[model samples]
Target chain A: MTVTRSKAASIRAARRDRWAQRLVQCGLHAGLMAWGALAVYPLVWVLLTSLKYTRELYADPFGLPKHWKWSNYQEAWVYAKMGTYFLNSVLLTVGSLILVLFLASTAAFALARFEFRLKGLVWGYILFGFLIPHSILLVPLAIFTRQIGLYNRLGGLALVYAAVGIPWNVFFLRAFMETIPKELEEAAIMDGAGMWSVFWRVILPLSQPALATMATFHILSAWSEYILALVLTGTTVSRTLPVGISLLEGHFTSNEPGVAAGMAITIVPVVLAFAFLQRYVIKGITAGALKG
Target chain B: MRRGRKRGTSWYGSPVGIFLFVFPAVGVYTALMLYPSLLSLYYSVLEWEGGPISAAPFVGLANFRQMLSDPIVPLALLNNGRRLFLDWAFMLPVALTLAFVLSRLRRGASVYRFLFYIPVILPATTMALLWRFILSGNDYGVLNSLLRMVGRGEWVRPWLSGDGYVQWSTSFPASWQHVGFYMVIFLAALVGIPEEYYEAASIDGASGWQQLLHVTLPNIRGVYVSCMILTLQGALGAFIYPLLMTKGGPMHLSETLISYSLYLLWQKKTWGYGSAVATLSFLLGIIAVALVWRFGRQRESALYR
Candidate 1:
């Protein structure tokens, strides 16, 4: 009778344990769901606000609009002068990306596979860029640019972006590249592959994830940059999206509903781009973090 | 291996020689980044309003002298300090907790991480503008509308328009925008902790909290330090939020050193004084980084063995 009672007690204990696990799991899901809502709600709200007419915007900031104003994006694109801004941002992003990728990849390759004197000093020099805030460097960067003919030119701004990007790019890419097996390069060398060929054929292909990671970060920084672009761009021709959108603030006079609409318009291309490349972006982040 | 040795015959013939072949990059780095930083230091010693065709007179520490005497300098420093503390208070624990919860899920973790990180891809101007609308004083604004529905009508006010609330009000949006980036960083670090450590602790009959303390916290020390440095630099460089949201204020209450300096440079054209401000910011940043590095290294070495 005692043995039968013990077996029954064990069964009851196991059931209780199962109940506790289920409760914990449920609580975790509930918490994550609340956080997820908090995260996505702001983005969704802005999208809905963008679709509202001005009357609806003023009358009800939180309510859904009776009619969708898809034309708001059209207005922002043309009348708000975002097309010019978009082109300028694209040029900047492309220019900076090309410059950074070339310089960073070259530097990273050399640093990873080569041994040299003053290597520690070289590494320290690169990391030193992180010590000062860009704000501190801006005054000097401006002066230096003015001294050169490139101060207000697109070429000069790209150079500045590339300079700032090189250190971190080299650091991150070097970390990843170091993990690549040395045997592959040795095998390539045995087949009479020159250093340039090896770098192009072997190293480049393997470093795609790292390169993608750098490209994502550089694009974001270049696209949304304000202070440097603001100070440097002297005309509508060179003004990027951030500065262009900022001018809308003056046009609206704190008619925040319009400003919200404008921002939502500005974000559409970037969001779409990210959405399409979502897989690569996740791969970029996870891989980037590991090396970093 | 034979190729490596053969290529080393000439000083500039090896793969390593390609490393020093970066003289062009080095030149650009020096001319663009290093020289400007040094020149700013020189300008900090001068006394002149920016003029297109005139020389700046040497002022020999006058800028430093003036910097010490200025009351606004201390205010900016304290403002940055408050932001760093507040960001740590809100972002660090919140990110850790969220990441912990997310890690346990069987599905949707990647999707959730992506959604949370979406705001980061938005322009800072967008974030600044979006929060401005949400936090606006009128009942039509989202927060106030929600407050009204809850019958807390007294809680709504012109958050950015008054001196009493300007500082705290501006910081909220700034913190909101940055929390995601750091959250990702912390999540990455948390995910790096080996599952074996937890399993070992469980076998030893450790509770959940005990495992967290004994296993999780120790592994993420490097990330914590790096996060602290990044957060500190970001707080000190605080410009976009104040610039877009408050234009440095209802009464310059939201002005940081960078904002004040940029106003001098871009608007007022007080170039010499602005460089002084820039120099002060640089010195403070270096010192802050050094302190954090020292503290972090000491903690790390002590924690090992």
Candidate 2:
């Protein structure tokens, strides 16, 4: 009789544990759903508002529009001259990005592959640059650029971008290149490849993933930079999309729809690009951070 | 150091080869970067308002004295304090909690991680614009509308405008936007913890909560310290968001140290005084870096040495 009673007690405890587990699981799902809604709500509101006319947007701010205004997108696009800004942005961003990658890669390769006197000293100097806030350089760089007659010029800004990017980029690429097998380089050299040839053919191709990672980061930074653009360029055509988008705030007083449309116009292409390239971007950023 | 590679051709030893290897980097650093940094220090002591260098008058410590007396300096510092507090309050815990939850999920974790990371990849301009609309005072704002439907009508207010609820209003959206990014970083740290440690703790009859306290916290302490340092530095130099959303006001309430300094130099053309603020910012940055280095060393000694 005592043995049977103990068996019943064990069964009851097991059931209680099962129920507790179920309760916890249910709570977890509810919490995640709430968090996800919080995340998605803002973007959804922007999208829906962008599709609504100004009249409907104000009249029923929270309601779905009876008629969607597809032309709003086109209007925002043309008003901002975002098309021209987009082209300019692409040119400048790509130019700066290429310069950053080439300089950073070569520097990183030298630091990683060669051993020399004061190598540690050079590494320390490069690393220290990362700690200096970029904002501190703004005023100084502006004056310097103006004095040199390079102010308001894209080529000038590209040089500045390369300067800022090279430090962190070299640090990151150096760490990555450090992991590449020395045997691969040795094998290439034995087959009569010179240092330049080995670097161009073997090492460069091998480091494509790191290069892509750096390029994507540079693109993201350069494409969205506003302060530098605001300070450097004066002309509307020369100004990039970020500054152009800021001006959208001035258009249409208390016009929520217009602002939303403007936001959507700038957002969609970038969001779509992010959506596609996000995996690589995440890997790259995380890898860079971890390597640090 | 490999034995077989010792006698290989010394391409780097040639004079032209050495120049090819090193000159480009050194040339860019010296002319474009280092020279300007030094020149800024020189310009700081001068009375010139961004004029040609030759026309400037020397005014030693006058700019520094003005910075000390400026009311905008304190106001901006106070604003930075608020930003730093709010960032620590919201971004830190929310990120840790998200990492914890995301780590436990069995399926679709990568998709969710990618979803959260999208904002991180967006240009800061787009991200700022995205939030500017989302937090606008309109009843159509997703946040305000949700509050209304939930019958919290009294809670809705102009987020980026007006003196009412100024502090909480601006910070919430800013924190919410960046939480995903910090969460991803924390998640990376979390994932690096080996699973066998957790299993061993469980086998030893430690409960999940206890194990987390004992094992997980200790393991991630280094990450926590480093991230905190990064976030603090980012907060100290906070700009773009407040500049875009409020232009640092209903009454200059949101203007940060960096933003105020930028205004001084660019808007008012008080270039000399602005350089003083920049100098202060640089000093603060150095202090932050020193603290991080010290903390890293202490933690390394505790954990590994």
Candidate 3:
């Protein structure tokens, strides 16, 4: 009878523990959900606001659009010249991605595999690039670009983007390449492959995922970059989306809904990229943290 | 193995191959970033108005001296310091706590992670614009409207326009955007901790909070330092948020050093003065990074010992 009483008391204690755990779990969920709502609500609010007529927006800032004005996107694209700006952004993004990939990968390949003089010094030099504030470089870069006759050119902006991105790119890619087995390169060399061939056939293939991650990151950064684009490009023909949207903001001061539409147009591609390639994006960013 | 050894020396290990592979990146990086940085040091002393380099008059140490005495410089630096402090005080703890909470959960963590990281994917400009609308000074603004809904309308003030509030208001969007970024960083650090440590703590009859205090915090010291450095650098170089949202308005109260420097260069056309500001910003950044590195190294060594 005493044993039975002890078991009953122990079971009651277990039940209490279970209840406490449940309560904690519910609290965690609540906190996370609230934060999640805060993270996403503004974008949703802006999107809905973009759909509403300007009058409706002022009248009911919090309300859903009475009529979905899909034409706002049209207006933003056609009339506001967001299309040209979008194209410019795409051009610069792709151009920089290509440059970064080619340069960083090849450089990383050599640094990862080869023995060379000043290797440590070179590594330090490149690593220091990560710390140098880009703002400090802005004045000189502007002057240098004009001196080189590349001022007001999207290509010049792309070149700058590529250069700024190279440090991190090489850092990440070199780390990734180090994980590739030395045996693979050795075997390729045994098959009479040159350094270029070995890198192309062995290293590049194995580094594709890392390459993709780096590419995604670079593209996102380049696409969203404003200050450099703002400083570099002077004309509508050369202005990227961020610059265009910023200019749009200035032009459409009173037209909140129209401006919001333009903002939405600027955001959609990035949001969609995040939606689809979230895994890569998260992996890329976290990889950066892990390395640090 | 023998053939591989010979072949490596013949082609793959040639110095020319290495040179060819590394040169393009080194050249471009030097031309665009390195050279320009060095040039800024040269330009900082010159009294030029964005003119040709040959025509500019060299005024050694004057620009730097002037910057040191400028009242606006101190204000900008103070604002940056305040922003950095707020980021560390609020952002670091919230992110760490949220990460810890997510790490403890058994399910749906990825969903929460994705949701939280949504703001991070948005451009800085978009974030600035969105917050501008939300924190708009007028009654039509979201925050003001909500204040009225809760019968606390009197508390509402011009967030981005008010002198007292503009700095905080401008800094908020950046903080909001990056909280998730640091959360992810902390989460990665937490996930990296060996499960055995937690198990051992549990076996010793330690509670959840005790385990975290003893096991988790000590293990992630390096990452914490890195996050701090990143936050400091970001705060120092803050430009987009102020540029897009407030334009460093209400008497330049919200302006960061970078924004002010840009204003000097682009708007005011004070090229030499702007270079001075940029140089100071760079110097301060270096100092901050060096301090963090020393601190982080010390902590790491102490922890190991």
Candidate 4:
């Protein structure tokens, strides 16, 4: 092959190409960084806005506040009744979490291990539960809870959250349990352990990682859940933070800062949870997507 | 003698143990989920007010007839269609591109990954609330304020007001919340594709865009299809956005089926009609999911192409 250009010229052209590639890379990364900033900007904006007074917020909605009005939090908590809503949300989330873990874990162990006549039917029951979209249940469940005397009660709401969680949790935990080696259960049984003892000591202990993953997963969902919480619960006393905040638009619409404070109260806990336990929550959600 | 494969040495295999182990989960699920969901069909055929459903007058298909005749019905359905279209059109390509770009970048992918997912983990109400203020009809709104700051104040307008804009305003908030989610999913799928695929593509003289078209997209088809199904569920069932941001609007222009059905029950107290809406909407969801499942599944492998 013959050289088409002088050596110095060819080298200079190669350097120009490399420089162009670097420029293109820079352009792409800059666009991506802008996208990331845009995505996160809302949460930061609302939180910052929450700390501004109404007049100050109106004056410069995009700028940092000259005087941080922490009273907005107090106003949202007390006047908007977000304090009660926060407590209700906490109670309901914790209550439902406990219910889901116990019921689902045991059921998962049985479905994973034992052979029974009704096992397929039982699994199909939970499986068929998926066939119906969740919104379909809002009507009857609202009425059924009332008829059965559990309506407007946080415990009842917890029970409903537990029920909604069962199908997925059982599916997830059962799959995880099936992957556990049979040797552990065999050793427990040979030690004269009954099914109860076996599950409590051997299987349950072994399933801690799955349980914790699911627990964090459940907290994230049940905490933020809105429609059902709105439907089932009655007044502000029974209302969760989300439903309460949704209604805050009606009552506190004029007080933008106060509303922002309510929004902050609603978001901060779950964001904090996601911050620390993201590994489990992200994996749980991704794995949870598999059933769909 | 061979031990029975169907039978076990454990007490869990026994009838009593099975009942004890399964009863709570089954009972709770049946009572709260299964029973109520299926009961909606029955409730759809009856008329109930504020009292117990037992005493409600049974109206055979009257609610269904009313729903078909309701004007809000068609509008709501159309809005849902718009949302579903936007979810697909906006989210899939954008998320795919973002995921692809992040995968190619030499630095800061980890921070971007975490930052991208923040909106997704927030409650739908929280997103709706943040966006509601951002798109407010006044100069104080974040969007308008930013616009004015940049001397584009003339471009600022109420995004969620009762009009065409009400439906579109939610598009960004919805996509913002989910783009990260689908990004992560695609990113995971991209990671699984062997590096040799790209190496071979580069050897074939494919540019980056060409590699994305020929190598990246084809590889992530399964994830993309599943993401389609997830997006379908999300779009069709979106409630909080409409419920908070627009409240189904000044003229009920932004109502989705789920939100409208909810408005019927909670506000109108037309239990039977609400049930009918919920039932039909859910049926639509099932049919949509099935259709996507059938159509999204690729019978021919992209590898051969």
Candidate 5:
């Protein structure tokens, strides 16, 4: 009788433990979902608010719009000049991506493959970029550019972006290139392929993953860059989206829905790019944190 | 560079080739980043209004004197300090714990990561604008609306426009987006711990909490140090939030050092004093980083011992 009683008690205890385990699991998942809501709700509210008439915006902050006011987007794009800002940002992103990849990748390839005097000096020089606070650098850069007649031009801004990225991009790609075996480059040399051919044919093709990572990263930074654009670009002729969208604040407080639409416009491309390039971006962040 | 032309040497390995490869990058970097930064050192000690044509008379520490006497300089510095403390107190612990738990998950981790990381991708401008709307003074403001619905109308105040609330209100959005950023960093660090460590701990009859204390936290010390540096830089370089949200006002209450320097540079055209302020702010950044490094290295040795 004692043996039977002990077995029954053990079974009950085991059941209770399982119940507690299940409860803990449920709580964990619930907490995760709640945080997820916190992350997503503001973005959703902005989207919903953009579709409302300005009157309905204050009347119902959380509810769905009575009418999906597509005109908010139309007016923001046409009247609010987000279209112009959007184009400028696109031009800047593409232009800088090309310049950055070429400059960073070549410098990285040479630094990785060649032994030369001043290599350490070169590395230290570029690394010094990180030491200067960005705000301090801006005033001087603005003065330099203005003297040269490039101050307010998108082309000049693109050059600045390319240069700003050189420090980290070169560091990252050089590290990546070092991992790529030296044997491949020697084989290409044996085939009588000259330096440019080897770099173009072997190194560049091999470094595609790192290049893609930097290209996306550059795009993100250039697209979102503000203070530089604010200090440098004096007019709508060259203003990027972030700076342009912000300029609306002083003049268009009544056009809150229009600004919401403008915000939506600014974000859509980022969301789209992020969706497609999510894997590379995640890899970029990990590498950036670990290696940088 | 002529070293490349030696017999049996690879063309790319030649000195000329190396110079060619590195030149454009180095030149552009020097022109844009390094040269400008060096020029700030010169300008900080000069009396000049910013155009090329303006005479830059050497001021020799006069701007620094003014910086010492300025009231807003300390206020701006304190604002950055408050931000750093708030982030460490709230964001870092939450991010670290979330990353730790998510690292242990066998399923649905990707979904949560995706959800959490979406905010990190948004621009500072978008975040500022979104939060401004959410925290607006009027009926459209989400927080105030909620308070009214709960019969606590007395609690509602103009978040950005009110007398004392501007600083915290601007800080809220800047801090909000960073949770995902630090989480991703910590998550990467956490995911990198070898399964063997956990197995060994379990073999020794260690519980999960014990393993976390003894094994997990020690492993991510390097990443945490990196996070600290990034956090400090983020705090000091905070410009967009106060600029867009509050315009550093009702009366310059929310000004960061950077925004205040921008005002001195543009609106007031005190270029010399502004350069001085900017230079000092950067010096503070370097000193702050050095302190973090000093403590980080000290703790690292203690951990090993």
Candidate 6:
């Protein structure tokens, strides 16, 4: 009878432990879900609010719009001239990506393959660019751009963007290039390929993944940059989406829904890009951070 | 001998090839980034408006002296310090907790990770604008509406309009945006831990919390230090959220060093003073980086020993 009683006690204890574990699991799920909700709530609110008429927004800030006014986006795009700004931003991002990839890859290739005097010095010099804040350079860069007649031009802005991206690009790409075996290049060399052709054909093809990652990073950063764009470009012709949207906010201060629509327009492309390339973006960021 | 000579003449060893490959990047980077940085140092000592560089008169150490005496400098530095403190206090533990929880999950972890990281991908301007609306000072604000719904209406105050709450209000969005970033970092570190460590701990009759303490945290000490350094750098150079939300307003209460420098240059048009402020900010960033490096190295050594 005592043995049977002890067996029953052990069963009860096991059941209690199971219950406790379930409770903890539930609590963990709830906490994580709550955090996820907080992360997404503001974005959803803005998106929905952008769809509401002014009266509906004031009536219920948190509610779904009674009538989904997609025209808000139309107005923001056409009437606010965000369309033009959007084009400029695309141009700058693409232009800068091209320039950065071409220059940084070539430079990284040379740095990775060659042994020359001043190699460490040059590497250190370029790496120092990582530490200098953009704010500190804002004044002189503005002056330099103006002096060089590149101020208020999209091409010039793209050049600045490329310059800004090079240090990190070179740093990351050099590391990537070093991992490519010398035998691959040597085989190409045996086939009578010059250094340029080897890099262009052999090395560049091999570094596609790293190049894509860096390109995405450049696109995201250049697209979202504000202060530099603000300082450098003074007019609508050259102004990027972020600066234009900021101006929209100022111009239509009381028109909350209109401004929110503009914000939504600015964010959608980024969101779409992120959705498709989430893995690459996350990998690039982690690799960069860890390497640094 | 002929093959060796041919190999030597190839592009990899050729000086012209090196020049062609490397000079463009080096030249542009120097002309744009490095040169301007040095020019900023030079400009900090000169009494120049936004005019011809040659026209400006050099006032050696005057801008620095003026900056030392400027009352706004202290306030801005203090605000940045407060932001760094708040971010470390709030973001680190919350992110760690979320990361830990996600790491423990068996399935759908990627979905949770994606959801959590949504905020990180959104542009800072959009985030600031959205947050501005949510924290709008009036009755129509989201927070106020929620408070009223929960019968806590009395607790609601003008979040961004008043001096008392403006700093916290401006800092919140930055911390919110970056929690996912640091969460991912910590998650990566957590995922990197070998499975055997946990198995050993469990075999020793260690509870989940005990395993975390003994196995997880110690293994991730290096990553923790990196996260801390990144957080510090981010806090020091924070510009966008404050620029959009407060514009360093409520009588300069929310001003950070970056925004303050921008204000001095853009609004006030005090080039030398602004450059001086920028130089000082740069100095602070260097100092912070050095301190973090030393602290991390010391802790790492202590742990190894």
Best by DockQ: 3
Interface RMSD to the true structure, each candidate: 4.3, 4.9, 3.5, 5.2, 3.5, 3.6
| Worst 10-residue lDDT window, candidate 3 chain A | A188-197
Candidate 6: which pairs clash?
A: none
Instruction: Give stretches of model 5 more than 4 Å off.
Output: A1-19, B1-10, B50-54
- Stretches of candidate 1 off by over 4 Å are A1-12, A254-257, A276-292, B1-21, B138-140
Displacement of residue A113 (Cα, Å) in model 2 is 0.5
Candidates 1 and 4 compared by DockQ, better number: 4
lDDT of 1 by residue, B1-305 (tens): 23333342343237445754455566666677777777778888888687652488898998888978987777666667767787899876777777777777667787777776777778888788777777777656667777877899888777878776767777767776666676677677778888999999999999999998988888877777877887778888887887888877666787777877777777778788878887787787788888998999888888784
Give the clash count for model 4.
Answer: 0
Off by over 4 Å in 4: A1-25, A250-253, A285-292, B1-10, B49-55, B203-206, B298-305
Checking candidate 1 for backbone clashes, the offending pairs are: none
TM-scores for all candidates: the values are: 0.92, 0.90, 0.96, 0.91, 0.94, 0.94
Model 6 per-residue lDDT at B75:
86
Q: Tell me model 6's lDDT, rounded to 2 decimals.
A: 0.86
Going through the candidates in order, what is chain B's TM-score?
Answer: 0.90, 0.86, 0.95, 0.90, 0.92, 0.93
Candidate achieving higher DockQ, 4 or 5: 5
lDDT of 1: 0.76
Q: Candidates 3 and 4: which is better by TM-score?
A: 3
Global lDDT of each model? 0.76, 0.73, 0.87, 0.84, 0.84, 0.86
Error (Å) of candidate 4 at residue B210 is 3.8
Error of 1 at B73 (Å): 1.5
Instruction: List model 3 lDDT by residue over B123-224, tens digit each.
Output: 888778878888898867888988888999898999998887998888777877888889989998899899999999999999978997899998888899
Which of 1 and 5 is ahead in DockQ?
A: 5
Question: How many pairs of residues collide in each model?
Answer: 0, 0, 0, 0, 2, 0
Which runs of model 2 end up more than 4 angstroms from their true locations?
A1-23, A288-292, B1-10, B13-15, B127-153, B156-158, B161-164, B303-305
